[model samples]
Target: MAVPKRKTSKASKRTRRTHQKASSNAVSYDSVLGVYKRSHYISPDGYYKGRKVID
Candidate 1:
């Protein structure tokens, strides 16, 4: 089995993981309902793309 030749340094490890950090979800405002919701998803009031999709 292949193995690493040396222990990874803290700085090197952290640098490699810089792009792996958690990111916030995309949110947008629902003008009709006057609320915020995740982008591309239906709002709590059953609206999608600025139209009602469910009762």
Candidate 2:
């Protein structure tokens, strides 16, 4: 009971969904602990690329 005998235009369904879009995680925006984070991790009061490595 299959279908789809040919009718998926729209640039081949957006080029096969181009990886299915919709993706996040990788924030990055903490000027010395001022907001957002996640890029290379390390910021929960520990800091990393912003110096002050735990301590």
Candidate 3:
């Protein structure tokens, strides 16, 4: 088993753990549907990039 030679500092541990948490998705307001949805993603109603993709 490999062992670490030096103990990790608080800043180092926190810096590594900074991205370990869940990130919130960005939202955008749809003028056509009049609802808030995830940015750059298709809505559940099947719309993408401000246009209907599927029914």
Winner by TM-score between candidate 3 and candidate 1? 1
Please report the candidate that would top TM-score against the real structure. 1
Clashing pairs in 2: none
For each candidate, give its TM-score against the true structure: 0.83, 0.28, 0.60
**All-Cα superposition RMSD per candidate:** 1.2, 6.1, 2.6
lDDT for position 5 in model 2:
94
Alpha carbon RMSD to native, model 1: 1.2
Tens digits of per-residue lDDT, candidate 1, 1-55, equal: 9999999999999999999979999999888888888899987778898899988
**Alpha-carbon runs more than 4 Å astray in model 2:** 1-8, 18-20, 26-36, 39-46, 49-55
In terms of lDDT, model 1 sits at 0.89
Q: How many backbone clashes does candidate 3 have?
A: 0
Off by over 4 Å in 3: 6-12
TM-score of 3: 0.60
On residues 24-48, what C-alpha lDDT tens digit does candidate 2 reach at each position? 7879788987888889888778888
Candidate 3, residues 1-55, lDDT tens digits: the string is: 9999999999999999998998899999998789998899888889887799988
